[model samples]
Target: GDARGAGRPTGERSGRPTGDARGAGRPGEARRDSGYRGTGNPAADRYAAKKSGAGKPRQKPSGPRAFGGERFGKDLGPVRRPKAARTSRPADELDMHNPDGVRLQKVMASAGVASRRVCEEMILDGRVEVDGTIVRELGVRVVPSEVSIHVDGMRLQLNEDLKYYVFNKPRGVISTMEDPEGRPSIGNFLKNKNKNERLFHVGRLDAETEGLLLLTNDGELTNRLTHPSYEVPKTYYVQVRGPMGPGIGAQMKEGIELEDGISKVDSFKLIDSTPGHILVEVVLHSGKNRVVRRLFDAVGHPVERLVRTQIGPIRLNDQRQGSIRVLGRQEVGHLLASVGL
Candidate 1:
């Protein structure tokens, strides 16, 4: 049986020595735990540990000087418990009920998202949020048009009164909703639409020049879209009577002096060319009367045809002439965000 430090008591301790008592004796040797020298046989190990006065709890040894040292007893410090994980309050626990507002499910149904029963289930499954907070309670209520809502991560427009549409105004159709002379106007195209609700054309497309025009009942949106401060770009596909001269794009982009102001294209790209004509795309933020026509006239190339293709983030891609199309929910969201609405 081993006989090293056998008489040492369990509770007693001292400064770290060159080697622990369980290790084989050699004054200058590094300390090793009992496991390093232990025999594979359990019975033999037990007998040896019994003789070596081990298998009893001893004082925790100071860690290496590298851990926290300049002193003999300094260690890595006490094992600490981590901060408690933050937990959100359960949906049902928060006060979501609004006695005066419409029920959440009903609002969802009214917005054409789903039927009341399905919307309720969706809420209970945590698929609905009101102003960024998930709502699971069936009794929650919100003013239909006052709060921002989302289902399955897509924003839902709750205001039924507000409507938006993109109209493909064919050439020669007046941009106004109605004209006294009974010429082809926007009103003629909307005769079959809901008659009671008033709609406003967002911006004008002159009687002879037409393409994409926005129509909506959202008055504030209309005002901002027309306001020059927003500088919303409009893209046009233009055809001009040209011998296709060089530097026209650069000169137009640099700015063309007119009676109103120095007008310029944000971008000018040559699309196609032939012996007698040039077709190009021009983007600019100017909302002046007959701006495109005058810009081309200044450059000595008369505008043969002009068709606006885009406004802000809205595109008039392949829409049939004189057809009216409703804006999708995401499209409306993007439109609203474009003007900081």
Candidate 2:
């Protein structure tokens, strides 16, 4: 007999033990030792036990996870946040139904007393009276042609038939229609042209200064054109007493501080140069009295002569001095449109 199968049962070398070696040895000893419970063959029994997991340990059951204090698989509908509050005023507080009339300050400003802002301040200070009653409230509306407005006890009238004219004002003639000293006035030009209408000059040129001067009976148009808000540009040909330095034009354009306010020029350029004198063209929008002369005076070079060549869209091209001419319909329309009428 072979040594490996010395103590085994018969037919063990052929991979099949006899009946007693398979299950007839002990009570539960054959099942555990042979690794096969129901099969009679020992090799067959070992193969069945390995595939069925007969010796493996079992795992324990676990619970589901928690999300926001609720079960992970449960539904929670939609999430919402609160709305913010509004900050604007209520609709009832606004004056939606405004009456149809021009503002009191606007009418006063158009009458040439002062600017709109200054007129408003004047009204609030009780210096203005409408139809014999004091009007201190703002936004008080009235038809200027229908109502009688007085400032400091002097009544104002609105001329309906608006007339516009351009005059080449000569030197040494007063800008006013009548001068208290009985000097040569603009009225002489109007009389020569046979124009008998009462007109006020838009802005004044000093007796010594000469050039284009606008005469109009339209108070509203006059105010609009002269007001600083409109920014109506005026061009002048100036002759200064000394030779201008290289940067004098830049200095003028930059700005100059005067007693009344800060004056600024839109542009300045040299037109001609002579011995001890320089002629330059300057453009500005200021309606202040003697602004052109004052600006040159502020600099070291005083103005020897000043002539306004243009006002807004109107120009004094080839117009003879001391002559007056009525503005055409197209020119009048253009002037009004330039200043927002």
Candidate 3:
């Protein structure tokens, strides 16, 4: 009987069960069914069939419909993004419209009253007067020949004939024009020439370290040449106490922090080496006091003797020690051009 049921057509078994199999249906139902048990009323049977999903299993959506096309409860549409702000024009692109006459502080600084920054401070403090009127405002431009500038009740005398000189500063000679200790100074070398004009040294070399020194009456050029902002390279020949190790040059070139600030050598080259001493040529733009000596001392190799061989375009090749000579027009021009003067 089980073999016969298995071989029977699916329609015959699906319709109704016979005899004892009919007992599987509920008491009120007329037939046993695989899905929803049908009621006698046609409308009720149709409702039951619809509620039970009488035919095939429900299928999911195929592609995009699986994910509802909505974001944060709103229908997704074209995305709106913000635009970037426009940038300002570069400095070079701006119009080149400069006012006439020299800046007030600049003129005062050029007259050897003080450095540019100090002159600005003086102006701000109401210590500077122009044309008999107290002018504290910066950026006030005036012609040197026309205006009367006074600092601390003393009138400034603008030096029309600015002179530039290269002096081979000798050892034991101070770098200043005057010293309270009555030490031999650069003024001793400049006495014969420009007797009345006051000149200032561009940079300083210690009394024991002798080399090329620039003396100028042009305070503006002095400020530009010596100011760290210009980064004018100064070359020096340094003799240390012992032979420099192989990695010393690399270390110096990298940089070292000192008490004042970090110091870095732009270029370092080992000139000669011996068991007793090491000679090195170092180029740097720093204008710190005793910077070269401090750098060597920091590396455990104290500098025995140091000499500045070059400053920007100027060189102290064969200039006799204790001798001073006026810089040629071409040399002066080159030096000025080096600092964008």
Models 1 onward score TM values of 0.63, 0.52, 0.53
The positional error of residue 237 in candidate 3, measured at the CA in angstroms, is 0.6
Q: Is candidate 2 or candidate 3 better by TM-score?
A: 3
Tens digits of per-residue lDDT, candidate 3, 257-312, equal 89988898999998988889889999999999999999989999988889998999
Clashing pairs in 1: none
Candidate 2 lDDT score relative to the true structure: 0.75
Best prediction by TM-score: 1
- 1-341 in candidate 2: lDDT tens per residue? 56877876675655555545554444554243434444555566657866775544544433332222323342743333232343433323323212577788887777667889999878767788776767766667776766767676555544447777899988999988888999999887676444567788988889999999999888888889888899999999999877666777787788889899888789998898889888989999988889888888998888888899999889999998888887765466567768854
Which ranges in model 3 have alpha carbons more than 4 Å from their true place? 1-160
Q: What stretches of model 2 exceed 4 Å from their correct place? A: 1-160, 192-195
**Full candidate order by TM-score, most accurate first:** 1, 3, 2
Top model by lDDT, which number? 1
lDDT of each: 0.79, 0.75, 0.76
The Cα RMSD of model 1 versus the native structure comes to 11.9
Poorest 10 consecutive residues of model 3 by lDDT?
89-98
The total number of steric clashes, by the backbone 3 Å criterion, in model 1 comes to: 0
